[model samples]
Target chain A: MKKHETAGPTLLRQLTYRLAVFTLIFAILDVGLVVWTYTSQPEALGEQLLTLEASKLERSPFLSPDELTGPPGARSWSARAVYPARANPDHPNRSGSLMDWTRRERLEHSIRISGVRRIERGGSPEWVWMELEADSIRPYIPVILNELLTHVALPLVPLLALMLIFNVLAARRILQPLRQAEREIERLDAEKMTTRLTEPSAPREVNALVRAVNRALQRLDDTMVRLRSFTSNAAHELRTPLSIIQLSLERLPESDHRTELQLDVSQLNRLVGQMLDLTRADTMEFDTGTILDLADIGRDIVSDMTPMAYSANRELHFDDFGSAMVSGHAEAIYRIYRNLVDNAFLHAPGESPIEVSAGPGPQISVRDYGPGICEADLSNIFEPLWRKDRRRNDGAGLGLSIVKRLAEAHHGTVSVQNMNGSGALFTVHFQEGMPESGDLKQTLPS
Target chain B: MRLLLIEDSKRLASLIRDGLQDQGFAVDWCETLNEVKLLRQLVQYDLLLLDLGLPDGDGLSLVRSMRRREDTTPILIITAHGELDDRVVGLDAGADDYLCKPFQLPELVSRCRALLRRPGASLSTVLSAGNVLFDSSTRALLVSGNLVDATAREINLLEHLLRRTGQVVPRPVLENSLYSMENAVTPNALEASVSRLRKRLKMAAANVQIRTVHGVGYVLFEPK
Candidate 1:
């Protein structure tokens, strides 16, 4: 599996988002506490200062104003004294008595500050004004903010880093079985039906998937075994009777009738053989790594079939070009060449030479001088049971199909093309660098 | 020579048996593995033509069992299984040779003769190809029922080529079997012998001819 860079939103990214949200909530709570305490505390301090100053003035009504001007105790405090003056009816110079001064006079003359409070506590109930400096409350604001940073944000940043790291590790740990299951599935070769995916040591949901896949494979394997058996049995059942017929025919005396019987029997045998070859090509287990010389195989086949070609009045020749060593099953390669040569003999014109050649490219070509295939029939040449015309019907039409299938089994291709002047050319090309073995297993249906 | 044929198909067995008998082999046909097992204990045979799909048991198992008991009789498997693996497995299980089904009678006869040519194998005294016959017992060569004189070396070359009737006989094999190593081997020694043998056989009106398979060797066959 290819590793991809983290460029999008992944599990880890979403985890980081949740961590940021948690930090935001912590900030709101921390800052909200400081703001609430700062606004409410100054008003309570002003009221306490006013009460103490009023009681002091009641004890010493003649205390000098200078005595209360400087700072008092823990708070910066001061007091203000007021004398009531109202219009006199009888004597213009006389001042109104302290008791006679109505509540209206005190209410109109009162002064207000943010941290100041007024109180009336003398025997005559006179009003005293006390205030705390604004600078006194401003200092505590910076102290509270510093305390917040040290206690909350400072430690929280590292804790969040540790949490992020731990989350990623935990996520990978939880997904380990899933990755293992994927590897096991990837390694399973369909050709090797005995291999089964291992039970993932994961949660129950993941195990269920693995078990289901294994069951499906078991069913498929059973079906394959049955199909293989059927093919083998069918070949046996069909060929045995054909053998009996051919043997019985051979026991008769030689005559024109026997010759005809021989021809029909031979034809029947070829058809049966091709039919089985087709089945085997489709279903047989093939392996690689066996090295064989293509030219050597061609020479041997060409030599063996020389007599047949001679009787047909067609000369068969092998144009050897050193050793064309290829990696494939020897039997399979032999069959490919045998089929090509045999097809040429059956279809090529009499008295013409059929040349089988090998090359350095690991290619084998069989050229026959006969009526070249029609353009329309070329596309369907490799299809099973394809006969161009009744006049040319000499086979069951399974030969070329079998050739195509066998070539494909070796990871090769079979192609045919009409020659310029005459005849047809059939070539099989094997890919280079084929694995010695198990390459076919990799291609099996999974 | 005596031969045992284990085959389940009655018609195929009968035809093969008649053909073998005509070829001077005393053939006993058994339709099942049990019959073969019983008959082998009672008699000794020169050859066994076994079919793979027997009624009672697989012919491969029979071959394996016979081999385990140290029986070295040449086993020629006539089977419908002609796959490469099938051939390899059959040979590995102790079969001497294998012939796929739907084979010609002449090829089967030839293969049987070839197998019997091994050392210590009991073969028929009379060997014939085309119109020529060589009787080992009487040391006589007859063509068209008349005696034809031939030298010992020529007879050996002719016999070797005739046994493998249609297959090519390489020059070296023919030369090695015809001459001894102690003799100063001449380049044309085999050629001279083959030329004289060929002319004599032609003068004698033998039905077969020795044709050279160019660059390979010679193959003897009846001209059609």
Candidate 2:
């Protein structure tokens, strides 16, 4: 049984392999022809010797005929004269008779010569013929191979090389659209699901694949839009009822149950707001060209939450090293800080002040002095709706998730770690520097 | 003081109206922008409590059109969208302040009062936080209904701090309010004024205290 191949050889390698096989087959054929020619040389050489002697005798019979010898391997060649029918009656051979010489030469020398011609010299005519005898034609082998190499193999080498190069370039040209599609797919993410692979000029097979992938992406984008809108609409719809509940609770006489109910309603409100924020972070197309100071956002969050923090018998503080300019949506960055601080307030001891700091770079961090997060739960803390204590109604556990999403939407990162001594630290790092006009537009939704 | 409330939800609007009326204000409720336009012509409400989401249209356009007519009436936006972008947009569209939904009645009342307390608004000139009061017209300081000695600079600092009673007023904001920009003011001048005011308030046994928020700013809060 053949093993399944996960990956095949590259296109260029496949073409090279085929070209090598073709060159090998051509070489074998050329060599076989050379060998066959070398093996039959003696027969062809004897016929050529006889023909040469007859022609020489016809041209000049009285002159000493040139020595009849074949190529370098021939041992020797000898010519014999025969009488013309008019010159000698009752001669054993007829003039220009090939059959008579063939019979005579076959009986004398193991090889036969058959040409008989009458040549006139000084008003007299005579017949002449020649035969060649040789031991071997081995010496011509190198010559034959050299001729094949120079005329066929040598030129074929460069031609095959050129063909390999042309094949590789042509294959690359043919697959260029696929490479582009691969890059486009690599760039696709939840944010860019709407982007489609657009290469109409690709080959039919690749274009079919591209179209299929595009359809899948379109379906995914449609689902995502529906999900986001559902979340947003649900959050919006909950706000009115929550407001009525809160206002109704406010009007009730002071009681422990009413106070608890108010807290519950506020918690529900916060959850709904976070849900809306999460949806917006997923879909909001913000201008990356707007530059904001991280220090200022930090200050705003600190000031805004100070009253609440104070009422809870906890303190909120802001520390700024310098102006930390970053390019992002100001509201998103503000949310990152606000969520972190809110999370810290939930965990930190009342007396211990939560420290929020920004600057030295495009970074902001919130630190809380409390029992640090369990090592096991640190990784799952940023997941939405995940809670350490599932029964606790204080938080819906969406704050950290929203923080993570908002940070990522701005091309930033959110990280959490246990501090040195009984505390947790959450930090967010944003990409610094203003984006170019082109990049800003690219960040916008299509 | 009379206030007009424009909100889409009937129950929430009635609740807010009742809450505001309980806070000693004449509150009129409407559910659409068109009614707000009609009511504005018939009655001179001191404040407009606008909800961003109304039945007829977005309240933002109403706020924009009102400002276009150069109407100085203060508008406070009550919204369900509490994101900073919405707040900035509302304020940029000429709304004086923003309050998110599901807020405590006290918070809503405080925000409304803060907006009405602005210089040209119909609220009284005297601003009070805890047991301390400062008369902006007379530049007089009183602790527990008794007049207390305070310098001009101290009075200025107290007025700014009293405006945002429980909130942190950034140092730059206090400095700009206390001293003219053209004044070659010393670096510690505002701090010096704050320190003297704190001492005077302490001497007078004022219920309110000016607390420094480290490097950020100051907050005036009633001591427990």
Q: What is the lDDT, from 0 to 100, of the residue A243 in candidate 1?
A: 82
lDDT of 1 by residue, B77-102 (tens): 99999875787789999999999997
Evaluated at residue B72, the lDDT of candidate 1 is 93
Give a tens-digit lDDT track for model 2, residues A223-341.
99998888888887788789999999989999999999988898999888898888887675655457788888888888888878777777777899776888877788888998899
The count of residue-pair clashes in candidate 1 stands at 1
Q: Name the runs in model 2 displaced over 4 angstroms.
A: A1-6, A19-159, A374-378, A433-446, B180-186, B222-224
lDDT of each: 0.74, 0.79
TM-score of chain A of 2: 0.73
Question: True interface contacts reproduced by each model, as a fraction?
Answer: 0.42, 0.64
Query: Could you estimate the TM-score for every candidate?
Result: 0.65, 0.81
CAPRI-style grade of the A/B interface in model 1:
acceptable
Q: Give the Cα-based TM-score of candidate 1 against the true structure.
A: 0.65
Candidate 2: what lDDT? 0.79
Which candidate number has the best lDDT? 2
